[model samples]
Target: MDYEAGTYQKLPIKQYPARELGETAEGRYWRRFLSPATAKQAGAVNYLEFCPVRPYNLAVTSSTRVLVYDGATRSLHRTINRFKDKAYSASWRADGKLLVAGGQDGIVQLFDVGSRSLLRQFKAHKRPVHVARFDPGRMHVLSGGDDATVRWWDVSEGKQVSRWEGHSDYVRAAAVNPAAHGTWATGGYDHVCKVWDARSAQSVLSVDHGAPIEAVAFFPSGSVLVTAGGTQVRVWDLFGGGRELACLSNHQKTVTCVTVSPNAGPDSSAAPRLLTGALDGHLKASVREGVYELERFQVTHIQKYPGPILSLGLSGDAGLLAVGLADGTLTVRKHAKPRADPAKAGILVGRRSRRAPALTAATYRYFIRGQSSKAAAKDSVIAAERKAALATHDKFLRKFRYRDALDAALSTRRAEVVASVVEELAARGGLSSALSSRDAAGLGPLLDHMRRNINDPRHAPQLAALAHRLLDVYGGSEALTGMLPALTLLLERVELELRAQDGLTRVQGMLGPLLAASVGAC
Candidate 1:
């Protein structure tokens, strides 16, 4: 669980016998939950939302039903199937007591979340209703539809309160400003995002987004708005003359949905993130920044899906992100935050506590002088000792003293030293004498070294010679029986390599004559 800041642990790129790299903390943190739970819907999912209240239940709209799920456990809680046609959007009232959904039947239905019963139904649009959401006060609900109108309905009376009809095409996205009462925003296929007020009969402000708007959301501060459509996500300042702030083009396909993290606040360490899902099956999060006239937004995190992403939902605490794909796959992933380290925490607190005394040149020089002299002296002594020992070992081998050379090489356990000694002994025809003993102890190390290098084409011949001698000397001893399996496997691998080499040589000989004839013709 120990994580160092600014350090990225890389995952393996290919299969191996070691533990999977995905088992690391950073890997597990960003990994998908269990295999995606398949939603048994007959049609593609259109929208998903998590309740704003405690327990944070989830709602998914697909076909003619709105399915409710336990947010924490990801289990189906209930289903509302009263819609006569496909349902498009599902949203929750601020109090968490009511659930509302717009349907292809051109009607908006409200249900009691606790009782799971239809509480109110109102005919709102003449065509398919694409979106519905509750106002900030929960006293009225707004619904936008394919009829190209955004209408407000008084929830207490279950009657239409007002309607706006500026959009030339389907009205697909809408959101109410929680910080500013009776203020809201809507986006449509007409490629415009309009801010509205209940006190006015006309839109108070409008911004052209350059493409059909599929989804829109207001920053928690109610001072900015984000509109997503086509391949871009644009942020507009609501309070600053309605100027365009930043444009993000991270998605490769149409952005189908967008949501803001509920836990995002002005004092947060980083900007509250805007999560967008696209038709290309990518879900990405981008940090929201302050007013910058021509800044470009960058994606901070991305999660890929198996099908086009149709809906996205973020839990209130920002702990979970739920994605609904067009193929009816519901995947929920937990946010991975960097773990806190006590050492780092202590250092940070200490730095802010009080200033340390500044260093003077005299003290600095005195500290360096004492430490450097001792370190230099120790390093020289160790280096000279190592050089002397190596010289003595080489002298024994040069004298053709096979036992002394082999013993020195074995004690060091250095591959280069052992290989050189074995090669020399084999060339001088002293290999059998070097291994001629039933001591078994010395023979074991030699056999082990040979087994380790036997398959390497460069060392195969020398190792093979040494292995053959050891087998002849100690092949019948009980002590050597335990190592036979390893020795047999090693020899088989070397034989396979030798046969493959011989086959390749034959192939080259046959091709050389044909290549020469073709070259001469050319």
Candidate 2:
């Protein structure tokens, strides 16, 4: 159907089923999985981090252990145990060979991924360490703790090189500047986000977010910073006098974690995308162009979990997204880009091919004869078969053979024929008998057709009647289990529409008396 040039095509709602609906291409970019619970004990997942380099293993911290799983397969590769207390903030070094984690025992532990051995342990803080990360150079580690101090440690010596004591509350968020040497950022319960340069003993910049900061991260270019707190994710431009660039407030609860893709940038061809997780079990991904504007930061996708989101991690290539939940469910989703449909493109090519030919008359005639004969013959055969099938279908309908008519219409998969057969059966009061006698195997296609057209205004009453009869016969059978979700969703929508219609009728009745009273008063 033709529409205004800038308008989008209005797709029929019935064309998309509950299982096949998504903001992006359905079934292309997203999938859900519940990680094997046997590998890790029952506890809230604390953090999830993917390796920065090759193999892209995922580290999941829960209870007292850190579990590593293959990124592609989600199979448990190894379990790093021996934590004296609950573990939190599992991070990977740049090389992907080492891992660092902070725990409730007031210690920072490092593990060698290749050997699965404890490489070093630093008794770095007086209280539990809440967040940790490796510096850009990988020579030192940065950690924040409940002791209200940001400490730096030399990995080789396993000793604290320096510490920054400024925040008066627990430091729960930290990140290393990817583009700047000797620079890092941190946020804490003190409601402040601070940026520090290692060359100096004090913070170089500070911003008051007006709420307790829960997570902080730097843009890939290191020219801007993102901080999450109470339901808001804010971006600041470091090079532009630390100007507040954008405030993204999409979550309904406290924002728990945030991460950015490594390839995201302001000047690159791809728009920079940000991923944020909140305590309300909502994960949102937003994108912005090079020109930073408050209204330009648009939400692209949102995924819901069963429990509060505790941690979020984006793969280095931005192809995989890992999410951890408070209910101990870990989900990994792969990002997919929609590909152009070759069938539609071929149709467009055929349309354009109808213009005048560029070849000589003799050449065109020769090629046309070679192609047209086979194509014409194939088209003629298909047309003849369709005509015969329609004749047979019409003969059954004329004789009031609804059962055979329905079978023929279903085989053709034509909406008009199917709807006519169903309507006719319902009008004749034979819907229940016709549907109930069919075997379970044959009932699937018929039920699917009913589900799709049940809410359509012209045929809703008849389709709904047919649906109830089918459910009555097959609701308890195992064969219907695979179709249960779709059927349930359709029925729920029908119920909602019926309630809405009832409410509208009541409103119209009340308005009639009010209108009459107003006329009398006038």
Candidate 3:
């Protein structure tokens, strides 16, 4: 009977400090929304909105026009270019039948989505109208403009319903409260945000946001308010008399837009998610309920853009995400379908094949019956099933060739492999034989490795012992005495390393007492 050779044993891998990984749930969730579709516009994309009704047609407002995209195909469905000057905001009604937008020409226009005809146009603002949104009842529209005023217009009457002129500067941001009728908020360049009731002309609530506010939003319950301004997104407790709940200052530049994800809930059982876009080219999703123990808000999702993000929008179902950038790029991401389990899919295919008619040569699957019948194993499974190939040094070690093993390890130019081989040779009492009869050229590689790795703490002791052994074997030989300069440099490196370690030790000792005192004080 013949015996197979034993497998070569691998060296013990050196251990290092383990690095901690952060939460991956958000990363995995956001990664599922793949297959991005992008469109180029004529100018900076300033606004993006998805229709609330099904098949969620997207509305993109750029320079002089608002382009409505077919939700199913993501193709341009309608182009409304009736503006005399640049258009600013394009808003969709709750029923998705009417579209309203404000323009730099100080005109607010409403259009019937089905007919693509202008139904009404209000021209009351003296300056550019920056924001226009429909009220919850769909009977009135609210608009804010650079004229430092917020106005409400009635669709049936085709005239202004009310005007509130409290803002000291340009009124750029406005949002209607979803849970409350006749309630809405407006933000302005005066760094103030005010909530108003349509029943009265006077403002009902007010808060100073400290910076020119760009965007504002109301929580689903209409109890919490969010404001985005210079690099900060603030959450306010409306029920608590407009007290600041959390000040999220994560962005490095001005936050241009903020919106609440439709999936967010009002109760604590489901944490609300806030999406903010900034001029720093980052879109961040933050959770109002704390994710970490001590953090007030946790930014869970982060996506980068090619240019400054000007506007962002999500569908009512949170299935589609749209981002508008300053560089005339509009990117839309649709949620991907979940993949079916492999075993279930295989079972379904097998059932179909068993009940089907005979395969024909004209069919594409007829020629490929054997090609994909057997599923390929995963990489981890394949690695577990296959044996590892031995290296040159490992092969020599199996044959009890210690000197050849050491030579092979040195030839590979890896300090860890060379150290492992030298340690093995020393254990087998073949270190002397491996170091014997080597000239200057043959020994250059070994000396160079020692010079490079003599100070590495992992292999320091082994290399030092080998260095002592080499000195003992070649100290008195005339052939090796000519290499004094190389040995001197090695000695200098060891001394320099020793000095560095001593300085670190002394500094640690000095810091120990200070750290202890600080801890005790805390």
Candidate 4:
């Protein structure tokens, strides 16, 4: 259970179900949708969540700080700060007015959307808080941390309610079923996700992933639960008291996170919609029903990010998304129109700068007028907002519109977000080497994504050798060439993380191309 500290030896990973894709009616439906999306230049994304209150909008991710984008306007509204030490995992509260994030410091912080102020910060856990969620009614926030603790906090009072302890190691995940109250789930290093009564601290169920359970979610009806692990998705009919209903497989890497489709609602289709993010940087969606549809299991698309994804949060409107990466890039994303003319695209490539944080005005007032009157209560609150904004640093991170900023970055190949990611990787002892030595055994989704990309001569070449390595180790590719540009940039952005190291470097060996390639590795 003490895996991070080496109390437990590394286990050989096995990505299972061993299914490629077989077409059916569902497969055709997916391909139809995918084709349109791809035609619109909408690539696969890493993380997605619908806003808790609003159904139409969402929060989507790229590789850098969160974005707040409007689905209708397709324009970014704001950005959340890139937490300096680590990526910030988020969940909107039931009201959709507040967003909570568990960041590197093992602290759970609250952001007030109306005022754009970091409302609170609490030492929520001993180790990093990997996952966090707010109670359905907005009275509480639940967080699972590396300390192997599941915590419930009184959101209104800003006080800790109780801490539940059962797992012997880091608690990797936690979730609240929207259709139920006081019922939640937590998973972690112990290789199981425990469903518990949030109020009573009573364990209701524990399901095995045969390895660590990375992520979990509930269907809109709360009748089924979806879990991600070992490249497959296991669906349990909670309606039948946690009976295993179906095991879905198609990915080629360790499944890192899962979420129900934004369309999950009472009147929605009986077929559940599922989305996934993984180590290979591919984001996929599937429609699961009575029987698993193989073609639907096929990855819808790929959103390229360098390194394993750390966390995901969808906006309330279902129009925006927030994705956090181990490399320190937290990206927010959404749908947008592409340039009609490539030559003129350069004019508005980078995001048009936004108005400075309103707090700057407050700071100016505080310096000039507030200093004249310490008795003014408004000055105190304004000063706090200024401090929080300053601590937040990047405009992209300060605004809640993180997804919009990411879209802007993607539009222009903006360098700031990638630069931040590289710095984090460097500090973490060079992520490339860690990835190389990971022993890709059991990474089916990753291999699947990669192998598919390799077959494309435009971006990726040398399919045979890469495919062989992939099958022999990870067994398939979960990524593709579409995301290569972003992945490459993500790696470069964070390469500075290794800058301070003493000649420790990354080593990647690949030939120019395969014999089948007519073009040079162009």
Which candidate wins on lDDT?
A: 3
TM-score per candidate, chains pooled: 0.59, 0.60, 0.64, 0.50
Clashing pairs in 1: none
* lDDT for each residue of candidate 2 in 286-347, tens digit (9 for 90 to 100): 77754554434777668877789988887776666788888887777655434466666655
lDDT of 4 by residue, 1-522 (tens): 112222222211223342456555434433332111111112233344556564434443333344455544444555666454553456677666777777667888877755757887777587877676778878788888888888889887888988887887788777777788778978787878788987687788877766677888887777678777777777776656777666666556888887765443222332455767777766666665334332224344455666566456544323344555545454555533222653355454447733445555557654565456456555545334222222211333234333332233233332333334223333444423323323323233333444334323332333233334433533344433343454454345335434633234322112224422422211
TM-score of 4: 0.50
Q: Model 4, residue 269: what's the lDDT?
A: 35
Better-scoring candidate (lDDT), 3 or 4: 3
Question: Which of 1 and 4 is ahead in TM-score?
Answer: 1
What residue pairs are clashing in model 3? none
Worst 10 residues of 1 by lDDT: 5-14
In candidate 1, stretches whose alpha carbon ends up further than 4 angstroms from where it belongs are 1-38, 264-268, 289-294, 335-522
Best by TM-score: 3
Which regions in candidate 4 have their CA more than 4 angstroms from the true location?
1-48, 54-66, 82-84, 262-270, 291-522
**1 against 3, candidate with superior TM-score:** 3
**Each candidate's lDDT (Cα)?**
0.77, 0.76, 0.84, 0.56
Worst 10 residues of 4 by lDDT: 33-42
In candidate 3, which residue ranges exceed 4 Å CA deviation? 1-18, 264-271, 291-295, 340-522
lDDT, candidate 4, equals 0.56
